[model samples]
Target: MSHHAKDLLTLAKAVIDTEIAALAALPSRLDDDFLHACETILACQGRVIVTGMGKSGHIGNKIAATLASTGTPAFFLHPGEASHGDLGMIVNGDVIIALSNSGTSEEILAILPVIRRLNVRIIAMTGNPQSSLAQAADFHINTGVDKEACPLGLAPTSSTTATLVMGDALAVALLEARGFTANDFARSHPGGRLGKRLLVHVRDIMHTGTEIPQVPPDASLQQAILEMTRKKLGMTAITTPNGTLLGIFTDGDLRRSFEKGQSLHEQPISALMTVSFRSINAHNLAVEALNLMQEYAITVLPVIQDGSVIGIIHMHDLLRAGIA
Candidate 1:
């Protein structure tokens, strides 16, 4: 590459290295204060109100969102806006988490008296523990970094990144403390792919009634093939007269029969079907069906209910629904 390109790459690497170093140094500083912050948020009966100014506000917004999504009820309040009648959002039981790298943001400091008057607890995250904001808080979390990634040290680079990481750490700690499960996460994110994977059941996507490819055990191989072709499932379920599943005849069975020089038109399907097959309950999640398919190397499974075949699920069904 050219000399100018090499110089640009060097500068980018320096910025990344500086941020990496800042993050690496953070764990040693996560002392009793970190635990106290987590406990305070966990014990909060009301919402967590996060506030900051400028770039700190941007990081605070993300922190609030992360906390909200991970079992803690939190929302961001612009410090400037909070002073202008928005301070009413705070209540006696609420917890305020204020972010300010310098620990003396005028907007944040402006609302301190009102917050104190309302009897709300404060958790200050700042680079300077001795700053007025930290000293005023019930708890202080030091997000101090040695230097900024910006060359002129005028931009909030390493400080913002460190603050964001600290927020994530806090959210995750609270999530684990609450015994939060994937099901809980799905409830909060019902519109996303995670919801589909965690909440969608076999019955939700499985084919039932007329859509199920089935043939009586006494039916001819030609009849089974016709049923499979008509249903377009690449296989046919062999059932007894009372609709109890007996076995399954699939395309693999047909290929083996052809190799054995068997008569496809005359033989009973029961004689060629595999009696031992994997099946899943209709109430199980769609992700379970995918796991069963991968574990047994099978593409389709019959959905069972009360010892009878209720529905059938295919790998394609899971894939089409974005569950796979």
Candidate 2:
């Protein structure tokens, strides 16, 4: 677009290309050390303690959050704080994952002896595999990058990305090993949309008793329209006297019947009702009901079990419950 804008785009692309190269090389570095790091964490009874210095500390905090959310009990420990009273946080049966780009950060190195004395296992992540920390640890994950995305080579760009990726790899591997399912993930994220979709059932949000709009097969179209208006569900379920669901009459059915010039006042609802109606069970997931609604291009569904209409679900109910 402009001279300066073109230069900016070129520089941005160059940075992305550099980081892409760094990440492309990261997979080749994962060997026995990566597997051992995973195995050790899996066998660990205590929580994982992630420690690092500066920008690596920021990345470690995120890594810890990812692991903690994905079935791994983990937290980030600032290495500088660990040198002080925070060192007491490490205990027997716990595992330490230390991150240091130079492999010899003073704050991180200062806690090595204390971790050793406490009989804790250390998994060192460093840019140099031959660094002092890597050589002394039980396992090492090399996150080395040939160069930085920053043209000045001062900022930790590509290296941090590589380290974060490696941390994600470890968390995912452990998640798979533990057989972590969506339900388990939802349990950990109870307040999020994923939890709502998995945990909220049709019974939790469906309208029941008088709240559901319903009428008999012999109900006049006007009677069904009044039921729909009173319940405000835009539809009414046609049920037998014994509560057996037979069909449903929605606004679409009314429109089609009216277009045919039928006598709305005298016509029975069953004459224009949709007999092949989709239904959901009360115990089924509300998200499943939403899928059914979307598949049939309908906005409402009757909750039926054994041919009896027990409840009804509206698309708005799903939206209110955060399931849609």
Global lDDT of each candidate: 0.92, 0.92
lDDT by residue (tens digit), candidate 1, 1-324 = 999999999999999999999999888878898899889888999999999999999999999998998899999999898877898888888999999999999998999998999988899999999999999998888898999999999799999999999989989999999999889988888878999899999989999999999989889988999999999888999988788999998888899999999876777899999989999999999999999999999899999877678898999999998998
Note the residue pairs that clash in candidate 1.
Answer: none
Decoy 2 TM-score against native? 0.97
Off by over 4 Å in 1: none
How accurate locally is residue 167 in candidate 1, as Cα lDDT from 0 to 100? 89
Q: What is the lDDT of residue 24 in candidate 2?
A: 99
Model 2 lDDT vs. the true structure?
A: 0.92
Tens-digit lDDT track of model 2 for 1-324: 999999999999999999999999988998998999999999999999999988999999999999999999999999888876888888899999999888988888878988999998999999998898988899999999999999999999999999999999999999999999999999999999999999999999999999989999988888998999999999999989999888999999889987999877876888889998788899999999999999989999899999998998999999999888
Listed in order, each prediction's TM-score against the native is 0.95, 0.97
Q: Candidate 2: minimum summed lDDT over ten consecutive residues — where?
A: 263-272
